[model samples]
Target: MRSISEIGEHHLIRRIRERAGDPPSWVTIGIGDDAAVVEPARGELDVITTDCQIEDVHFSRAWMSMREIGAKALAVNISDLAAMAAAPRAATLSLALPPALLVDDFDAMIDGFLDLSRLAKVPLVGGNISRSPGPIVIDVTLIGSARRRRILTRSGGAAGHLLFVTGSLGAAAARIERFEDTNTQGSYERSEGSYERPVFLLNLAREVAANRLASACMDLSDGLADGVSQMATASGTGAVVLSSKVPVDPTATLEHALRGGEDYELLFAVPPRRRRGFEKIAGRSTTVTCVGEMTKAPDLLLDEGPLGGGFAHF
Candidate 1:
């Protein structure tokens, strides 16, 4: 395979731009321009979020393919937008790469990133690329939209709001554990299914936001325990998370479900009066469960003990 140094940066950029296909009509200017120019949402608020995926810190090259890494870099940013019931509009990717990287591998990474972007209908707008002295780095910035007054915020919960989480947790965390265990012995296996492509909760979150079903909301990228505590702290209320109500993955332990981050599910709060309305929207495909409730006091308790920290990057 030809190395990145052989193809040169400008050529790689041109190839990526061509491979990105066409942008939506809303995107007035896409990849070739100095910066992306897009039409504003007619009746909604623009939501923007950025996330980074660094080699080793986020994923080891020994454990995952370049393509999977690229897909994951975008997915995490999309998850942030989905947490607030936002519809993805456009995305920009900045990559820091070593010149020794293979051109085919770079193409594979772009393919993976664009595939998910196409699936989400978020066109790649514009971004920068630079050479890295060490590991590869991928940074994604996603722009999304949500209707005014209908966006979900972490601080919207009240004392009587019922807490709910979408989908089961701990699968990703369990997979990470496996990666760590095997990597210690100088070998690693890619987990079945795209652990890199996490479930996007935009549809469910949009429905809940549109219907005013939830009072507070956030994505569980950092485990259920941290999610609950965050929402409670942001909303200035206490929280009570029932251990029995948490939907743990079949292959994962309860500890993994609670503290193993990267679940990428939605955690939201709905008032007791609107519980039925929320339930009507949640159906079977969504798998939402009432795991807790917001309280008047400021204490955050999971079952009977204090809710601890999770996945801190200190």
Candidate 2:
């Protein structure tokens, strides 16, 4: 058996892909991308998703506050829904907390979830809590609804469709790198804030669904390259992402933009003719850029180069 480190990231991904099998019909999109999309029924589309955050695995209690953890747990799942071009309506949370956690601490965490829920206009419908002998674990599941024929699926992208991404990438990844560097100071802490408070692009999802402007859509949760590759694979197409056209934080490196996770931004495919309309709808606050174009082949190329990878979980 090959060790994960020895196999490297791409090889591990290939191995996983071989075992995962084809996506289901309702799953217009599946495991390869930033988020999966499932069509619940005809005329009405419901997006279903879940994400888990474990202490030390996904975050560190030493660096992250209870509030941040709570908010992130919810935001990330909703971000998945947004990727499907759906509007989140309800959520359920399951928490495993250490015995040492005080009741007040738990309350603060709930408060954080509630705060973001209110902002997103999604409510917490139900949940479960329990004591854990191990590290803290948070699992969140969200359900979002979309109008008939409006939900975007990764499989919809085709050759000639233009690829676009919303907001800057790599800020969160850069922040995490800074936090790991002992030589860093207060600035590093500030950078980490981006990771803690990710903006969920619900409004963008609504616009895409309403206008049917996007040929395909998914959020940038795992990193731009990985997300785009997923779309290509599902749609039975290929893509060429120009590195220069990708929007990255001024302070972040190109590598970070390509592989960073937790950015919670949207990556979509649109018809060339609709490019201007999407740009106008995205507006000034959110940076939208045409990073690539879909191709007939199944390969995912970056700047006409080999595949640019993104974050992965084994």
Candidate 3:
């Protein structure tokens, strides 16, 4: 199989552009230009988010396929936009390919990338790809838009606010633990299969924002405790998460549920009286569980205990 070097930058970019297919109607100019040109709707606030996946640190090639990595990179960043209740617009990718990588792998990555963009109705406007002597790196920048009042943030929470999280937790952590223990990726249908990609709570977030159901919101990227702590501190309040109320994946531990990051589910706060309204809005389309409550004190207590350190690079 040929390497990326064999195809050259121009040809490689051309192939990727072709794979992305035509740009959406809202995009004026896409790949092959100096920068992507997007036409956002009037009065829509632009929401931008970036996330990266690096070899050894964020992932290992031996544990997952190239396409899965690509999907994961895109999904994580998009989930950030969802936390803000933003509508996805376009995305840009910056990839550093190791010399040992095959051209086919790069192509597969683009396939995964395009698949996500299509599903989310977002366009891949532009990106830069380079050769690197070090590990493979993928940095994704996702752009989204939302109305002024629709933008959600962590600072809006206050004492007495009810805390809720979308979907289950700890599965992603369990998957990583199992992978580290066995050095095996395992099947996608398994309990930990959800770890492979993030579930962007876009619709649920929109409903929360549109109805003003949530006072604060964020995706659980750095784990439940860290994310909840961040919201509490940002809002000038404290939080207490009930251990029993936390929805844990059957295969994962409570410790994993507390500190395990990258679940990509939304952790949000609603006013005391708005719980029923928020639940009504979310309906049966998604699972929203009340896990905690905001407190007057300024500390993060996980069931009356201290919060653990979440994922950190340093």
Candidate 4:
């Protein structure tokens, strides 16, 4: 068996296809496209989330520019808001920078953060910056507002619900491996291009919120399997994913989809009756796959099999 770095991106995604499954009711879209959309609330629901990016753990200076780092940090957090089908209004950023980094580079990083903020139409209201003895770190907290009935959450899923994901999986993993290979050949541009630019699925979120299509929702920052498991745990339900139907990146392989993190896509669930509406909307867009279904059991299964392998954080 080859490691994810050796299998390349597309091949890794192919592996994920073998274990993917469908989502529950209200999930309008799932993996194999640019974004995921879900409806979990009826009227209005507020959304809140926080995420952190560490220099050596989440990223490295050797492979990422300060600008890219800043943008990615902000994008990941906003992606969380999008998962809940909420409109992000403001964010607070906290930065811990090492003294070794030049002041100009720091300024560029701030510019990058601001760039993403403007693009998302979310203001950077306040934050704290300080020196760090180790590598750079960034923590961002985002606040979003949704109608009380429109807010989506990870805990609403139940038995007989369908499963869904937004966007193709494994692109980021493929990009990482590609970067390593290209860097060895002194071709940095191609490697950089493989790195995913943060995508704001605000439009999809708005649609889901307005429609009340998702019973539960969460972002795939870790991995598809892990994200679904989190949702299952939150909702006190079990799930079964079909290994063959998972939507993966055309260029990525199974390994990438199973273990790669940082995809920053959305994963959601909905009841069975609402699956048609989801399919109808998804048909006009990119492929939104039915990867699995929810169960009353508390276990999370992949490809209708036991769950053991996937990404994990220590």
Candidate 5:
């Protein structure tokens, strides 16, 4: 297969646009344009989020396939949209590629990403591609929309709201730890199913938003501790997370579940009054679990002590 250098940028861009297929009606303009133009639904507010994945930092080429890497890049951004209970509309992907990267590998990666995009009904609208000096980088910017009254945010929660999370936490972190410890991906391929496609929980988020069930919400990209801290800080409240209540992944430790990050599960707060409604909606999903509650005080505590650290970029 030809390397990116052999195909050149313009031709590669054409191939990408061709693979993206036709844009949906809401997209006034898609790829091959100076910028994307999209029409939002009446009375709906837009929600936008961006996420980046870099080789070595986010994934190792030695273990992760390009397809898995691409799916993960889009999945992370989608998780952000899900946190706001928004329906995805369009996405832009910016890629920084080494000249030596094979065209076939890039195609495979795009296929992986597009597969998820189609599943989510998010069109590939626009983006830029450039040659990188070193490792590959995939960055995605996603745009979504939700009715103003139905949008969820970290600042809306109050001290008396019950804390809940969708799906178990720290499985991704555990997978990473296993990879690091073993230095081989072969033994854990079966377990890595979750790492490839992190749960977005958009449907559940929408239900909570539409029913006004959640007072606050965010995705757990940085683990439960960080999620709790952020939500509490934004809402001008404190949090009391119970270690015993946390639904740890089978292969992960309690610590991993608390601060390992990359879980991509929805973390939300429901007021005591709305508990019944929230529970009714969430009960449809067996993965939902209640971990703790918001507090009037300003400290974030796991049990009786302060919360610990999670994944940090720096």
Candidate 6:
């Protein structure tokens, strides 16, 4: 019931450590330090990604609990790791809390972090918290690892590589669209699972990397159009996306599939010769669709013509 201002920074941190429990064996140092320290086992490279979510800008307390917000924060960061085929290991959080925020909400938010950290096998090692003059802001830095040979990047693609994406697109955008049109995104009491949950293609990405099934890779955060354009620019190749082949949610329009953001699906380029092999390895466990092919023309085209772009923050 108490506000964060009442307990002060020291006590609030003490409570956080208490909630975090004992550090895992790999952690050489944890909270209470100027910085965390860790020693990874030999033969693995570290993969790190960070993200920031602000109240109202990224989410609203009226729609989700502070805890759900916490989980979503980690999910987005993990999505970046998924793009690199990284196995999540540890995380650090930076929180800027307003004076009027309740202590209970802080605890709930940490609870969300704990839930995801466990699911992703990423432990909370260290972080910082400070007073904010305005809305709640959470910045999470997640560290993951993969063997050097298994790391995937966006710049490896080439002409004749087929572009593949995991799962359906536009659901998150559709969810937000529903929220806006209906005036109630979802029951304020329960967060919408589609937007709250992020799909991390850890297994699939590893398979693609290990087998050399993909030539280039990145997460489809912005829509398919943007994802293809990005991969094209990074690999110095053009992409020809089939307008009819892009997968979309039942509720979303084709435009939503093309321009929606925050899908978190993996957008990858595979050689035509490896496409069948990738599909065989991908199996029926999840949807992996080939929506386009890399081209030598150096242009992003849809069905042999120019394609529109997704949401732009600028």
State in Å the error of residue 302, model 6.
2.0
TM-score of each: 0.94, 0.81, 0.95, 0.78, 0.95, 0.93
Q: Which stretches of candidate 1 lie over 4 Å from their true place?
A: 184-200
Q: Put down candidate 1 lDDT per residue, 116-197, tens digits, no spaces.
A: 8888888999998899999999999999898888889999999989999887889888888977877654334445544423
Report the Cα lDDT for candidate 6: 0.83
- In model 2, which range of ten residues has the least summed lDDT? 187-196
Candidate 6 is scored at a TM of 0.93
- Residues 141-211, candidate 5, lDDT per residue (tens digit)? 99888988888999999998999998788888888887888888541243444533343488778888898
Score candidate 3 by TM-score against the native: 0.95
Question: Candidate 2's error at 194, in angstroms?
Answer: 6.2
Instruction: Say which prediction, candidate 1 or candidate 4, comes out ahead on TM-score.
Output: 1
Candidate 5, TM-score vs. the true structure?
A: 0.95
Q: After superposition, how far is residue 237 of candidate 5 from its true place, in Å?
A: 0.8
What residue pairs are clashing in model 1?
none
lDDT of 1: 0.85
Which digits, one per residue and each the tens of the lDDT, describe model 4 over residues 1-314?
Answer: 32234443344233322222343344455433444455544454557889999986787666777777887888888888877778876667777766556655665577777777767766655456666888889998877778777778899999989998777888777777876766643222323422233434666755765777778887777777787788888999988887787778877886687667667667779788888876666445545677898889887898757754456667
lDDT of 6 by residue, 122-165 (tens): 77888899999999999999888999888889999999998898
Write the residue-wise lDDT of candidate 3 on 129-227 in tens digits. Answer: 888889989999999899998899999999999999887888788878888888775333323433333434787788789999989999888888888
